[model samples]
Target: DTAVSQTPKYLVTQMGNDKSIKCEQNLGHDTMYWYKQDSKKFLKIMFSYNNKELIINETVPNRFSPKSPDKAHLNLHINSLELGDSAVYFCASSQAVQSTDTQYFGPGTRLTVL
Candidate 1:
Protein backbone atom coordinates (compact mmCIF):
# COMPACT_ATOMS: atom_id res chain seq x y z
CA ASP A 1 0.00 0.00 0.00
CA THR A 2 1.05 3.58 -0.56
CA ALA A 3 2.50 5.09 2.57
CA VAL A 4 1.96 8.63 1.31
CA SER A 5 -0.46 9.81 -1.35
CA GLN A 6 -1.76 12.94 -3.02
CA THR A 7 -4.93 13.61 -5.00
CA PRO A 8 -5.42 15.10 -8.47
CA LYS A 9 -2.01 13.90 -9.63
CA TYR A 10 -2.38 16.28 -12.55
CA LEU A 11 -3.99 19.70 -12.31
CA VAL A 12 -4.35 22.26 -15.08
CA THR A 13 -5.87 25.64 -14.38
CA GLN A 14 -5.81 29.22 -15.49
CA MET A 15 -4.04 31.96 -13.62
CA GLY A 16 -5.85 33.47 -10.65
CA ASN A 17 -7.68 30.24 -10.05
CA ASP A 18 -7.68 28.55 -6.69
CA LYS A 19 -6.65 24.96 -6.19
CA SER A 20 -6.06 22.48 -3.44
CA ILE A 21 -4.04 19.30 -3.23
CA LYS A 22 -4.98 16.74 -0.65
CA CYS A 23 -2.43 14.52 1.01
CA GLU A 24 -2.59 11.62 3.41
CA GLN A 25 -0.15 9.28 5.05
CA ASN A 26 -0.84 5.85 6.45
CA LEU A 27 2.59 5.11 7.87
CA GLY A 28 1.54 6.34 11.28
CA HIS A 29 4.09 9.09 11.11
CA ASP A 30 4.09 12.05 13.40
CA THR A 31 5.54 14.62 11.01
CA MET A 32 4.46 15.68 7.52
CA TYR A 33 5.95 18.12 5.06
CA TRP A 34 5.07 19.98 1.88
CA TYR A 35 7.66 20.61 -0.78
CA LYS A 36 7.51 22.36 -4.11
CA GLN A 37 9.59 21.41 -7.11
CA ASP A 38 9.91 24.23 -9.57
CA SER A 39 10.35 24.01 -13.32
CA LYS A 40 14.07 23.71 -12.75
CA LYS A 41 13.44 20.63 -10.63
CA PHE A 42 14.76 22.32 -7.54
CA LEU A 43 12.82 21.11 -4.57
CA LYS A 44 12.22 23.49 -1.69
CA ILE A 45 10.55 22.98 1.62
CA MET A 46 7.27 24.85 2.05
CA PHE A 47 5.80 23.70 5.29
CA SER A 48 6.11 21.10 8.01
CA TYR A 49 3.61 19.78 10.50
CA ASN A 50 4.32 17.63 13.52
CA ASN A 51 1.54 16.12 15.47
CA LYS A 52 -0.95 18.46 13.77
CA GLU A 53 1.08 21.49 14.76
CA LEU A 54 2.89 23.83 12.42
CA ILE A 55 6.58 23.54 13.19
CA ILE A 56 8.40 24.84 10.12
CA ASN A 57 7.10 27.26 7.54
CA GLU A 58 9.38 28.48 4.79
CA THR A 59 9.28 31.75 2.90
CA VAL A 60 6.24 30.80 0.90
CA PRO A 61 3.74 33.37 -0.24
CA ASN A 62 0.62 34.09 1.72
CA ARG A 63 -1.36 32.64 -1.14
CA PHE A 64 0.01 29.23 -0.24
CA SER A 65 -1.27 27.61 2.90
CA PRO A 66 -0.75 24.20 4.48
CA LYS A 67 -3.63 22.85 6.52
CA SER A 68 -3.27 19.87 8.79
CA PRO A 69 -6.61 18.72 10.09
CA ASP A 70 -4.95 15.79 11.82
CA LYS A 71 -1.71 13.92 12.09
CA ALA A 72 -2.49 11.76 9.09
CA HIS A 73 -3.36 14.54 6.65
CA LEU A 74 -1.83 17.73 5.38
CA ASN A 75 -3.48 19.67 2.56
CA LEU A 76 -2.08 22.43 0.41
CA HIS A 77 -4.33 25.25 -0.72
CA ILE A 78 -3.25 27.94 -3.14
CA ASN A 79 -5.18 31.13 -3.76
CA SER A 80 -4.92 33.34 -6.85
CA LEU A 81 -2.66 30.86 -8.45
CA GLU A 82 -0.14 32.24 -10.87
CA LEU A 83 2.15 30.86 -13.50
CA GLY A 84 4.87 30.68 -10.90
CA ASP A 85 2.77 28.12 -9.07
CA SER A 86 3.05 25.69 -11.92
CA ALA A 87 5.18 22.87 -10.65
CA VAL A 88 5.08 19.59 -8.83
CA TYR A 89 4.01 19.56 -5.21
CA PHE A 90 5.15 16.69 -3.07
CA CYS A 91 3.90 15.44 0.25
CA ALA A 92 6.22 13.65 2.62
CA SER A 93 6.11 12.16 6.07
CA SER A 94 8.60 10.89 8.60
CA GLN A 95 8.33 9.02 11.84
CA ALA A 96 9.51 12.13 13.57
CA VAL A 97 10.99 15.59 12.94
CA GLN A 98 14.57 14.47 12.89
CA SER A 99 17.23 14.99 10.27
CA THR A 100 18.20 11.38 10.40
CA ASP A 101 14.63 10.13 10.05
CA THR A 102 13.66 8.66 6.72
CA GLN A 103 10.91 10.48 4.86
CA TYR A 104 8.53 8.86 2.42
CA PHE A 105 7.36 10.96 -0.50
CA GLY A 106 4.11 10.85 -2.40
CA PRO A 107 3.81 10.55 -6.17
CA GLY A 108 3.51 14.32 -6.42
CA THR A 109 0.80 16.56 -7.87
CA ARG A 110 1.68 18.45 -11.03
CA LEU A 111 0.03 21.87 -11.16
CA THR A 112 -0.02 23.74 -14.45
CA VAL A 113 -1.19 27.31 -14.64
CA LEU A 114 -1.80 28.93 -17.97
Candidate 2:
Protein backbone atom coordinates (compact mmCIF):
# COMPACT_ATOMS: atom_id res chain seq x y z
CA ASP A 1 0.00 0.00 0.00
CA THR A 2 2.68 2.44 -0.89
CA ALA A 3 2.05 5.52 -2.97
CA VAL A 4 5.68 5.92 -3.98
CA SER A 5 8.94 4.37 -2.84
CA GLN A 6 12.66 4.67 -3.59
CA THR A 7 15.31 2.13 -2.72
CA PRO A 8 18.25 3.07 -0.51
CA LYS A 9 16.52 6.23 0.69
CA TYR A 10 19.93 7.39 1.90
CA LEU A 11 22.90 6.60 -0.31
CA VAL A 12 26.45 7.22 0.82
CA THR A 13 29.13 6.70 -1.77
CA GLN A 14 32.50 7.92 -2.91
CA MET A 15 32.87 10.37 -5.76
CA GLY A 16 33.02 8.96 -9.29
CA ASN A 17 30.96 5.88 -8.44
CA ASP A 18 27.98 4.94 -10.56
CA LYS A 19 24.61 4.60 -8.88
CA SER A 20 20.94 4.30 -9.69
CA ILE A 21 17.71 5.07 -7.91
CA LYS A 22 14.46 3.29 -8.56
CA CYS A 23 11.04 4.94 -8.34
CA GLU A 24 7.47 3.69 -8.64
CA GLN A 25 3.98 5.06 -8.25
CA ASN A 26 0.73 3.17 -7.84
CA LEU A 27 -1.60 6.14 -8.05
CA GLY A 28 -2.69 5.40 -11.59
CA HIS A 29 -1.11 8.53 -12.96
CA ASP A 30 -0.46 9.06 -16.66
CA THR A 31 2.41 11.51 -16.15
CA MET A 32 5.54 11.26 -14.07
CA TYR A 33 8.48 13.54 -13.43
CA TRP A 34 11.92 13.58 -11.83
CA TYR A 35 13.09 16.51 -9.77
CA LYS A 36 16.35 17.45 -8.14
CA GLN A 37 16.44 19.43 -4.92
CA ASP A 38 19.74 21.02 -4.05
CA SER A 39 21.09 21.86 -0.59
CA LYS A 40 19.38 25.23 -0.91
CA LYS A 41 16.04 23.41 -1.21
CA PHE A 42 15.48 24.76 -4.69
CA LEU A 43 13.35 22.26 -6.59
CA LYS A 44 14.01 21.95 -10.29
CA ILE A 45 12.41 19.69 -12.83
CA MET A 46 14.94 17.43 -14.46
CA PHE A 47 12.64 15.33 -16.59
CA SER A 48 8.97 14.70 -17.25
CA TYR A 49 7.34 11.80 -19.04
CA ASN A 50 3.79 11.17 -20.05
CA ASN A 51 2.85 7.67 -21.09
CA LYS A 52 6.49 6.74 -21.69
CA GLU A 53 6.99 9.88 -23.79
CA LEU A 54 9.34 12.58 -22.63
CA ILE A 55 7.46 15.82 -22.23
CA ILE A 56 10.10 17.98 -20.62
CA ASN A 57 13.87 17.95 -20.48
CA GLU A 58 15.61 20.60 -18.43
CA THR A 59 19.20 21.61 -18.93
CA VAL A 60 21.07 19.07 -16.85
CA PRO A 61 24.36 17.29 -17.07
CA ASN A 62 24.74 14.29 -19.34
CA ARG A 63 25.78 12.22 -16.36
CA PHE A 64 22.13 12.15 -15.29
CA SER A 65 19.52 10.13 -17.10
CA PRO A 66 15.88 9.19 -16.65
CA LYS A 67 14.01 6.09 -17.71
CA SER A 68 10.32 5.37 -17.64
CA PRO A 69 9.16 1.85 -18.21
CA ASP A 70 5.55 2.92 -17.90
CA LYS A 71 3.66 5.98 -16.80
CA ALA A 72 3.61 4.58 -13.30
CA HIS A 73 7.35 4.32 -12.85
CA LEU A 74 10.33 6.56 -13.51
CA ASN A 75 13.91 5.83 -12.52
CA LEU A 76 17.06 7.91 -12.31
CA HIS A 77 20.52 6.70 -13.26
CA ILE A 78 23.76 8.51 -12.69
CA ASN A 79 27.07 7.76 -14.35
CA SER A 80 30.36 8.48 -12.65
CA LEU A 81 28.53 10.21 -9.86
CA GLU A 82 30.33 13.29 -8.66
CA LEU A 83 30.25 15.24 -5.44
CA GLY A 84 28.29 17.98 -7.20
CA ASP A 85 25.54 15.43 -7.76
CA SER A 86 25.11 15.09 -4.06
CA ALA A 87 21.54 16.14 -3.38
CA VAL A 88 18.03 14.83 -2.87
CA TYR A 89 16.38 13.26 -5.89
CA PHE A 90 12.62 13.20 -5.84
CA CYS A 91 10.15 11.28 -7.98
CA ALA A 92 6.89 13.05 -8.63
CA SER A 93 3.68 12.34 -10.54
CA SER A 94 1.21 14.68 -12.10
CA GLN A 95 -1.84 14.42 -14.32
CA ALA A 96 -0.71 17.13 -16.71
CA VAL A 97 0.75 20.58 -16.91
CA GLN A 98 -2.49 22.37 -17.64
CA SER A 99 -5.42 22.76 -15.27
CA THR A 100 -3.30 22.99 -12.17
CA ASP A 101 -1.65 19.60 -11.91
CA THR A 102 -0.22 19.25 -8.47
CA GLN A 103 2.75 16.95 -8.17
CA TYR A 104 2.89 14.32 -5.50
CA PHE A 105 6.45 13.77 -4.31
CA GLY A 106 8.03 10.71 -2.81
CA PRO A 107 9.87 10.61 0.49
CA GLY A 108 12.95 11.72 -1.47
CA THR A 109 16.24 9.89 -2.10
CA ARG A 110 19.16 11.54 -0.45
CA LEU A 111 22.51 10.99 -2.17
CA THR A 112 25.71 11.68 -0.36
CA VAL A 113 29.17 11.54 -1.94
CA LEU A 114 32.49 11.68 -0.23
Candidate 3:
Protein backbone atom coordinates (compact mmCIF):
# COMPACT_ATOMS: atom_id res chain seq x y z
CA ASP A 1 0.00 0.00 0.00
CA THR A 2 1.17 3.52 -0.67
CA ALA A 3 2.08 5.21 2.57
CA VAL A 4 1.27 8.62 1.14
CA SER A 5 -0.85 9.46 -1.88
CA GLN A 6 -1.98 12.58 -3.75
CA THR A 7 -4.87 12.99 -6.15
CA PRO A 8 -4.62 14.22 -9.75
CA LYS A 9 -1.06 13.15 -10.45
CA TYR A 10 -0.99 15.87 -13.11
CA LEU A 11 -2.74 19.22 -12.97
CA VAL A 12 -2.92 21.66 -15.87
CA THR A 13 -4.72 24.96 -15.62
CA GLN A 14 -4.64 28.48 -16.89
CA MET A 15 -3.33 31.44 -15.02
CA GLY A 16 -5.74 33.08 -12.58
CA ASN A 17 -7.44 29.76 -11.99
CA ASP A 18 -7.87 28.08 -8.65
CA LYS A 19 -6.96 24.47 -7.95
CA SER A 20 -6.48 22.16 -5.05
CA ILE A 21 -4.34 19.11 -4.44
CA LYS A 22 -5.51 16.52 -1.96
CA CYS A 23 -3.11 14.49 0.11
CA GLU A 24 -3.51 11.59 2.52
CA GLN A 25 -1.10 9.51 4.50
CA ASN A 26 -1.82 6.03 5.80
CA LEU A 27 1.32 5.80 7.92
CA GLY A 28 -0.44 7.35 10.88
CA HIS A 29 2.01 10.19 11.06
CA ASP A 30 1.21 13.19 13.14
CA THR A 31 3.09 15.66 11.02
CA MET A 32 2.53 16.50 7.37
CA TYR A 33 4.23 18.98 5.07
CA TRP A 34 3.84 20.62 1.67
CA TYR A 35 6.88 21.30 -0.45
CA LYS A 36 7.14 22.96 -3.81
CA GLN A 37 9.77 22.18 -6.37
CA ASP A 38 10.28 25.02 -8.81
CA SER A 39 11.40 24.83 -12.40
CA LYS A 40 14.97 24.97 -11.20
CA LYS A 41 14.25 21.84 -9.16
CA PHE A 42 14.83 23.58 -5.87
CA LEU A 43 12.50 22.17 -3.26
CA LYS A 44 11.20 24.51 -0.62
CA ILE A 45 8.93 23.85 2.32
CA MET A 46 5.71 25.80 1.99
CA PHE A 47 3.74 24.60 4.97
CA SER A 48 3.70 22.11 7.79
CA TYR A 49 0.92 20.73 9.96
CA ASN A 50 1.18 18.75 13.14
CA ASN A 51 -1.81 17.00 14.60
CA LYS A 52 -4.12 19.24 12.56
CA GLU A 53 -2.46 22.39 13.81
CA LEU A 54 -0.54 24.81 11.66
CA ILE A 55 3.19 24.88 12.22
CA ILE A 56 6.29 25.94 10.31
CA ASN A 57 4.60 27.97 7.63
CA GLU A 58 7.25 29.26 5.27
CA THR A 59 7.38 32.53 3.34
CA VAL A 60 5.16 31.69 0.45
CA PRO A 61 2.69 33.79 -1.44
CA ASN A 62 -0.66 34.37 0.27
CA ARG A 63 -2.24 32.68 -2.74
CA PHE A 64 -1.08 29.36 -1.35
CA SER A 65 -2.88 27.78 1.56
CA PRO A 66 -2.58 24.55 3.49
CA LYS A 67 -5.52 22.88 5.13
CA SER A 68 -5.44 19.85 7.38
CA PRO A 69 -8.78 18.25 8.01
CA ASP A 70 -7.20 15.58 10.22
CA LYS A 71 -3.90 14.25 11.32
CA ALA A 72 -3.57 12.05 8.26
CA HIS A 73 -4.69 14.54 5.62
CA LEU A 74 -3.15 17.78 4.44
CA ASN A 75 -4.42 19.56 1.38
CA LEU A 76 -2.97 22.41 -0.64
CA HIS A 77 -5.17 24.99 -2.26
CA ILE A 78 -3.78 27.55 -4.64
CA ASN A 79 -5.68 30.65 -5.63
CA SER A 80 -5.11 32.79 -8.71
CA LEU A 81 -2.55 30.43 -10.03
CA GLU A 82 0.24 32.07 -11.99
CA LEU A 83 2.89 30.89 -14.37
CA GLY A 84 5.34 30.75 -11.51
CA ASP A 85 3.06 28.21 -9.83
CA SER A 86 4.03 25.59 -12.36
CA ALA A 87 6.00 22.99 -10.50
CA VAL A 88 5.79 19.71 -8.66
CA TYR A 89 4.10 19.82 -5.29
CA PHE A 90 5.02 17.12 -2.87
CA CYS A 91 3.23 15.93 0.22
CA ALA A 92 5.25 14.38 3.00
CA SER A 93 4.71 12.94 6.44
CA SER A 94 6.84 11.84 9.32
CA GLN A 95 6.29 10.38 12.76
CA ALA A 96 6.98 13.86 14.11
CA VAL A 97 8.36 17.18 12.91
CA GLN A 98 11.84 16.46 14.16
CA SER A 99 15.06 16.79 12.28
CA THR A 100 15.86 13.18 12.95
CA ASP A 101 12.50 11.89 11.81
CA THR A 102 12.37 10.16 8.46
CA GLN A 103 9.85 11.62 6.02
CA TYR A 104 7.81 9.64 3.51
CA PHE A 105 6.96 11.53 0.31
CA GLY A 106 4.09 11.09 -2.10
CA PRO A 107 4.57 10.68 -5.86
CA GLY A 108 4.01 14.44 -6.24
CA THR A 109 1.43 16.47 -8.14
CA ARG A 110 2.70 18.35 -11.14
CA LEU A 111 0.94 21.63 -11.72
CA THR A 112 1.29 23.48 -15.00
CA VAL A 113 -0.14 26.94 -15.31
CA LEU A 114 -0.54 28.14 -18.85
Candidate 2: misplaced stretches above 4 Å?
Answer: none
Rank by TM-score (best first): 1, 3, 2
Local accuracy of candidate 3 as per-residue lDDT tens digits, 3-97: 99999899999999999999999999999999999778888999999999998889999999899999999999999999988999999999998
Which pairs clash (backbone N, Cα, C closer than 3 Å) in model 2?
none
Local distance difference test, each candidate = 0.96, 0.87, 0.95
Number of colliding residue pairs in each model: 0, 0, 0
lDDT of 1: 0.96
List of clashing residue pairs for candidate 1: none
Q: What is the lDDT of residue 94 in candidate 2?
A: 74
Kindly indicate the candidate among 2 and 3 with the higher TM-score: 3
How much is 87 displaced in model 1, in angstroms?
A: 0.3
Off by over 4 Å in 1: none
